[model samples]
Target: MVLVGWGEQVFRAGLKGRGCGVDEGLRELAAPFVVPDPSGVAIRTRLKQLTAVDEEVLRRVGAHLGTLASGDLKARCHDGLAHDAEAWATRKRELTPLSSARWAGAITRATHEQWALARRCALAHLQSLQAGVHALRHRLSLPLGQKGSKRAPGGYRSRREWHAKARRLRVLEDRLARERAAWQAGRVHVVRGGKRLARMRHQLPAAQLTELQWRARWEAARWFLRADGESGKRYGNETIRIGPDGEVSIRLPAPLAGLANAPHGRYVLTGRVRFAHRGTEWADRVAVNRAIAYRIHHDPVRGRWYVTASWQTPASPAVPLAAALGHGVIGVDTNADHLATWRLDVHGNPTGNPRRFPYDLSGTTGHRDAQLRHALTRLLHWARTCGVRAIAVEDLDFTAEKTREKHGGRKQFRRLVSGLPTGRLRARLTSMADAMGLTVVAVDPAYTSKWGAQHWQKPLTSKNRRITRHDAASIAIGRRAQGHPLRRRTTPPRAHRSDVHGHRIVQAGGDAPGREGPRRRLPGPRTRSVPPDAERTRATRTPTTVRGVRGEQEWVPDSLLLTD
Candidate 1:
């Protein structure tokens, strides 16, 4: 626990101070304050534990600081170049996690499997800021034309060009507005200062260094006890002893050896676990199995202790797309609140009744998880009933798309984006569907909603039923997966008579036949023998002429004249 205490103190101090990274903080401040290690914990392990805590704080703070910078720059850009440049210069030194300390601390202490997570977050945010700067600069560089009360003769583009420039300016204006909003709201913070940690404590059970280390131990409990290339002796091995009454004892690693001698040794470092159906197989392979890894964990919610064992399993055979499509497919439309699904035959025709399974995500983590589980269960059950071996869904990603919404997008749209359960739903569906012997097919999401609404909506809707845009989208998604054309076939319209003599026209409408306009009759076949002989003698042919209105007239030739 000494490492935890020291780490927490150092982290708090680092946040208060201006300089020093994780390594510098450790060497300059925390390394000097080492306490007694009576438990035989190595210096290396202690340092690692401390580093993990500090790294977490840095990662979270860095991410927010980058966002803070971007927001400031955007706001400044809106006012003027001078203001934008000034703010950009100042943000490098001024941004910090101090503004929202409780939220910052809570986020920094969130559970992460790796220390590199913080660096990744910081880098990602920085890159995003750079991209925004480039885009904004490019937009600002365009020839937007002069703005004035009166138009100048040659100073502006045509109406079309002017409208396009106006559109670009409006887009830039909206982006800046979003940035300002993001800054005002402190984009990354979960909640405000007072009573925040108290509220999040349950969600974050292992925020402290000691608790974190314990959690790590449980996670890493499964380790392969093997030999070196030459010595054939295992490192980090535990001496396991079994009693006559099926009791078990274990001598743990150096850091945990003191726990082995503690009063709660059995509960802390060792405990008995039943093997169940694989008991005999495990017993037989105790000394024979090349790989021997075991893990033990406690489910805080269930109040139960369980042991886990791992073994390599063979890979499942790959199912070809063509083969899977032979059995028909289930088209799924993932939405913010529910999954919309429909079954389609091999020919892309809807075969069964559509289903909608709703789920609530605006709840506790456990509650959301339970809701998702129930939804997936029902969807899969229905899929099984339909006897479709393959399911088609949109390959979607919203992170980058939604990132700017928190600052620049509409409030309703932003809320909808935030509440979308796309990622988690996709992951859960894939694994569960696999376990139930079904194939998951991902298709392009482009124009599915538009095409679906345009073609499928009215057809799917009826006197007794109303089809939603998403339901139509689901059908579109399935059809796209099966490589079918989005447009439906229609019978050709009948031909219509035209104003031109002896000619017909193909009309698009189903209107009744009627005189569109006055028609002109063609002249009878011409007699040319005498006229040709006279024209040959003249050595030239006269051109045709037409009469004018108001009794005006023009000359005409026999072979090239109009008849009255």
Candidate 2:
């Protein structure tokens, strides 16, 4: 979603207004000519002075008419009408009205206007048709590397766009020549002005002086034109400036000289939209990490101006950190759940996160990791103060990669990426480390996690394997862990698996493999048995009564501990 910003000034529609009203003027200029007058005064006129069409031809000479867009054609047509209308009127004044020449005069003048409009439009259409064919031929010349149907791979075109133009061009050219010759050769002049009409030339006002200026502006915007699909010519923001003052002063492009609104699909009748009280302006500059303006459009329903721009963000750069104890190599494993880090010392043996590993910020060690940048910033600052030397991080190639938002259910990957404090962490860490002359290394992250954090009392086997949770971390102490550690009993931490799960198994004995002995037992239950049947019988039999040396109380029961 793009936000509406400034530069709403580009949507004004009054520049074309400065130019003549092509159709309206043409109709007015034609009105007098098309009616008969009682007085006759042989009016003389020059061929070039009569119409917008003369200008149309001159413009079309430079215009790739066949390639001329509809907007361009409409513009040209507007110019033609305006000019032809005025010229037609001026020359018609040269002829005195006849008492009986009303209908004839109107028909003759109307015929002249139609003929001119048809010729210009048809010529543009024909040229476009031929150009289109040539272009298609070039495309078809390429090897059809693969084969299929009309819409197949590597095809020329699915449909031709300039067919009708060719027919119209041929038809109009034929008709114009025939009529011109008929009039020039003194075929007929039913009304008083009819003879002078043949000398008048017609041009549409849409493509006249003012309109040509707009076109020139469009041509100047090379790249912008390519990107925005040639959105017609702009008049240097004058339309907007003019509307506010209710007055306009502008240099006229020859094409706009006698311009007027065309009746059906007329030049001004089309892409020219008129709005009430809208502000428009040209953009001066665009900033970074901010939205870039796209375009301004006028909404008829809202009656309000809106602008749209989108923000393009940069990638998450890396940060390097190092400390004493020869810890330089850093391993980072990022996943959907958490980021695991291993800090390897001088000998390349990696240690796990410390109680104060500087990554943890809030909840568990994992929470600290989530706020990686924030935590890194603090830790890096602390490290700098403590005089750490070098910092290292894993380096994996990004190489033109893009993350695909999973099309399935809610993507766990996207959530994890969003929640990570990636960008800030990298920036702050890199800055702090570099300032302190701490070497920042982005090394391979491949198998750094294979070795457990520091040395494990037990092997990396299933029975002894530990997995860190989203809320826990394993903290590695020194070589001998110093003192007996006072047997500070507490909950054990979780494990890391992303790039750490190695293939080490633990043995049942206390010692790892070669140094182990048989399993030790604790006081529990008798699990041994004597000779089977005989022992069983002895245990089950009752003892016989025996005479013991008579002491006055010689009543000892024959149950001396129940010997088996």
Candidate 3:
């Protein structure tokens, strides 16, 4: 039997033959690669100290532009597979009279982006449905109560489960067919205010919100106050512009142009926006007339307005893997509730004690994001203090693993896997680490936990220092990123008890002599009762046999008695 440790649980899997070992049937692992630096940077600053008139003007402008955006999105969706550049230009032309040419351009661009995102989501949904149908079909084909192997799930444990699964299979099949048809026809379902928030309208009590608050949030979410940047334009953007002096201004739509307080149909808010983070970069970009997009939005819960500035940066050259790992790395294992981390040396040996940065993933989206960011901040600080150049993490994707038909009754496991912030962690870490000049390396997630538990867990654990499976898995991740095998060293075969076939791989250098020899004897007695020289003394002891006597010789006592 082979024991596999998944998260905190260890499960036993039977091997087909006694000759097989824990390493048998393991999937090939992918090579570790450095996560490239983020190609875009976004900075947010609060828009404060606005007068009542300014707020009214801003609201009217945002609403007007938002209506235009909504109409454009609807038109784009209607075009679907038939959409072309000509159709896109025509939509922009229709909006230009209502909004300015720049505002129309931004709205049309946003519409195209939203439509593309919806298509991508539809494709993903179709793939997920296909996976579910395949899993359900595979399981339903087997006999009821049949056992399964490591690679695939078994039959249902009962007739009731079998019948339910059969029904679910039909449902999935129908959904899959519909999704496939929609994908082919380029039809996508998208909600202006997120689908989740839209549903909360019917469940206001459960959402802990009153009708007014929900309406406010919903409208705020659907508002399109974002404007794309254009090079060689005034202050890098013509629609929504923030001057180098931190003055916020917006080019109003035709209907709201009458509300403009500034020259040239632009409204300048009394509030100044200062981006404490990356302020210098934003100022520099504005001075150079580089393209920088800006967005203005209101948070209903906070009762505040904020402006976000974003711009794309050129992709940095890919650093060689060796250079990235030259100063070693901190391998991080992302869990549902915490991040498990451990530092390793250049040789892939773990250094110091393991550390865990805990964070709560339950609560509102903003709360969860804040918790995750806080945890990651602590982790990055620790890594920086250790002087490591890179952070290693598993490239985990639990998309297919979250299917109900795949895990069956293991609802807890499914939820656990689903709750893991694999994608978010990678994105956040890569972006954060890039600013700090630290590389993020992603390694294949296969067998890291299982092999780490088998090899490094207990050996690193002691009364003073307790190492969990996640900590051990961090070590495995670091080693894999450093191009080392997960196992510390390979053991010799039982018959040889030495490296007779070849030298043991992974731990020692090939140039080391006597690598296969028995361990050197220590300078003390092996046990309390045995002296240090006992073996030597035993070897020199005399033999009791008479060397000159034949095989059947009689006893010499008879001759001795006659002489007496």
Kindly give the number of clashing pairs for every candidate: 2, 63, 0
The sequence of per-residue lDDT tens digits that candidate 2 reaches over residues 358-391 is 3433365445545665545554554455443444
The residue-level lDDT of candidate 3 at 466 comes to: 84
Measured by lDDT, the strongest candidate is 3
Cα RMSD for candidates in order: 25.1, 28.8, 11.9
Question: How many backbone clashes can be found in candidate 1?
Answer: 2
The full ranking of all candidates by lDDT, starting with the best, is: 3, 1, 2
Off by over 4 Å in 3: 1-24, 491-564
Question: Poorest 10 consecutive residues of model 2 by lDDT?
Answer: 5-14
Q: Which ten-residue region of model 3 has the weakest summed lDDT? A: 10-19
At residue 179, what lDDT does model 3 achieve?
85
What digit string (tens of lDDT, one per residue) describes model 1 on residues 281-375? 44443434323233333333333434344333345566777877788888888776778888999999987678899898887877998899899
